[model samples]
Target: MTTEVSTRPLQTLLAFPFHEDRWQSKMLIGIGLTLAGMIIPIIPGLILMGYVYQIMHRVIVDRGSLYLPEWDNWGKFLKDGWRLFCVAFLYSLPTLVVSFAGMGIYIVTFIGAMTAAGNHPDSPASILLFVAIGILFLSIGLSILTGTLTFLVLPAALGHTVARDSFSAGFDFTGWWKIFRANTGGFLIALLVITGLMGLVYIVSQIFSMTIVLICLIVLLPLAVGFYVMLIGAALVAGAYREGVENLELAELKLAEASIVAVQEEKPS
Candidate 1:
């Protein structure tokens, strides 16, 4: 008999990074790379994101293993990171397009409003100004909503893509959607847990920032916390995916068994 894989989002979130004997060194490297990425720019950041993707991939393949992976294979990290970037970029395109369009409308209307105000103060210039302001605000709200939804959906998409080792899998909305629907509760819980962890880190960072000496740590502290949080979040997401997929398989199996039973009953009677 096959043992059932259980979902332990909270346990995995808090323990995965520290489960290994060399967790200290591993975490240090991760945090150091994150800081370096912040200082240097694109390349290191991409590599780090790719490393996080590996964590997700590992969890899925290993049936939710809690050990942190060693920081090796720079070439693979860079390549995988590029794929991660592409996935994120494509997902974010809708928000970007909306934002740019809104900005364009706002600019044109603002200019018209100013031009009209200069010539005819009592004309529709004020109305145009109001419309522009309204559009800008509306765009900002839409962008935020779209961006948040994208962030929530991204982990599931990335998990599917990473599992298949295919960049195109990230774009398979119908596929991921089915997986996501299978365990929406699990995904939402993971999201809430990660969000809470980040919020707690932010609060602590703010407290540290208040001190003169500790204020110096504001930069390093958040980076370290954020890196760990990323690892934890990735693991949680992968676990959720595993649970969701297994649930789907089990459901299908039960359906098949029921159909077989029904067919046998119909034939004999």
Candidate 2:
């Protein structure tokens, strides 16, 4: 008998991080991403991100089991991590560029406004105050909206990249849109779940400072928590993407069966 695929988003989301089956191995991977790799004084954090990307790839495409990633393959982890970085960097670029450009424009215009106010005593002080307030509100509003959008679409986009095994796949708008449409609610919940988990990780790391020694806590707790958070994020995303992939597989299977039936009907009796 075939095993029932764990495609339910919420159940899939909880399984990787919390399931008793392979928790120890998962924790070891978290260490490799965080504390263990940091021993080399290189960008282990980035390498860890790549490692996380591989896990998402396995779940979304290979339908591989969700368990701890083996830490033995340093080279492979770094390469995959780099690919993940490239994809995410592309996703985040537009917001970064717009934010910088806006801030630059605001600074230049604010300086001009200040100069004008000084030169003309009749200038309304309220105008300067309004611009300051406007810029503040604008910056905050843009940040929130952009961040939410980026996070909301991230899992689907990343999943597509993994499914296709190419960086270019991340930009496949039509493909990712279908996946996103299939799992809208799952993606949203994954985003919320990930955001909260990250915050909790940070808080735990901070709390350790008071309860434990500073150097030891920093060396041990934070990086471990960071890696664990990364694992959880992957699980959450994989859960959402699983729905799309399973649907896609089912459709393809049905189409194949239909084609087979048509061929038989066309055969000479």
Candidate 3:
């Protein structure tokens, strides 16, 4: 008798070929475009985000990899990015509403608690308690809900569907919670590593003694770091999406192939 192996749950879509040909060149170009996008000043951040979104969708989703043509079709990418931004903005309304509404409730609860405690302004204990409880609830609720939304709803938006349909798709995709749970440790580790690297970059620049280099650093460092961070995030999200979809396709293919093999074996050989 042979022991059977259990099928592991699917991990987040992260299928980008980080080690493949011309990836570094594409990454550098992507970062540069992201930085130039920052020069617009007022809405530069949003524009930069749009650019990153475009690169991810166009290069990763459409091209089947992140090794894209360097600045060859940026205008088209930007257009797609803008379209995605608008859709994502609309999709995110519920999250924004929940955040503000939750904040309002916390404020109201705090005020009520303070009033009940006494008219004394020195009573911070009650306020502290209110904040602690509020933050705890927010952290738990927001992390889980946002994680689920990002994992599920993003696919529909990426696929250019309506908000309601996207949300429904998210609900369906999110039913496989075990996959998310299994990958939690890896996600947390990656998050910490990225955070540490960013912090180190900030710290090293501040400690440098060369005045001219320091001045240049002060101006360019934040933008560089920000762009790089955005690129990494976009890549990771794109990878997760690809991984999920491909895995689903692979499973279907395997089942079909197995069925064909069974039928052929029964017929003659």
lDDT per residue as tens, model 3, 59-85:
334745453334455555555456656
- Candidate 3 ranges with C-alpha deviation above 4 Å: 1-43, 58-65, 68-75, 86-95, 112-216, 265-269
> What TM-score, to 2 decimals, does candidate 2 have?
0.74
The C-alpha local distance difference test score for the whole of candidate 2 amounts to 0.76
Which stretches of candidate 2 lie above 4 Å from their native place?
1-42, 124-129, 203-220, 251-269
What alpha-carbon RMSD in Å does predicted model 1 have with respect to the real structure?
A: 3.9
36-128: candidate 2 lDDT, tens digit per residue: 565765478667877787788778877877766666777887777777778888888777866776677677767877787888867885387
lDDT of 2 at 216: 71
Clashing pairs in 3: 13-239, 13-240, 14-239, 14-240
Report the C-alpha lDDT of model 1 over 1-269, residue by residue, as the tens digit: 89987767566568767779888998898888888986798888888878987887877766756667678788898888889889989999999999999999999999999899889988866689999999999999999999999988987898888888889999999988888988889888888989999999999999998999899999989988998888888878888888888888898999999999999989955
Residue pairs with colliding backbones in model 1 are none
User: Where does model 1 exceed 4 Å of error?
Assistant: 1-9
Ranking by lDDT: 1, 2, 3
Q: Would you estimate the TM-scores of all the predictions?
A: 0.91, 0.74, 0.54
Q: Name the candidate that leads on TM-score.
A: 1
| Alpha-carbon deviation at 2 in model 1, angstroms | 30
Higher lDDT: candidate 1 or 3?
1
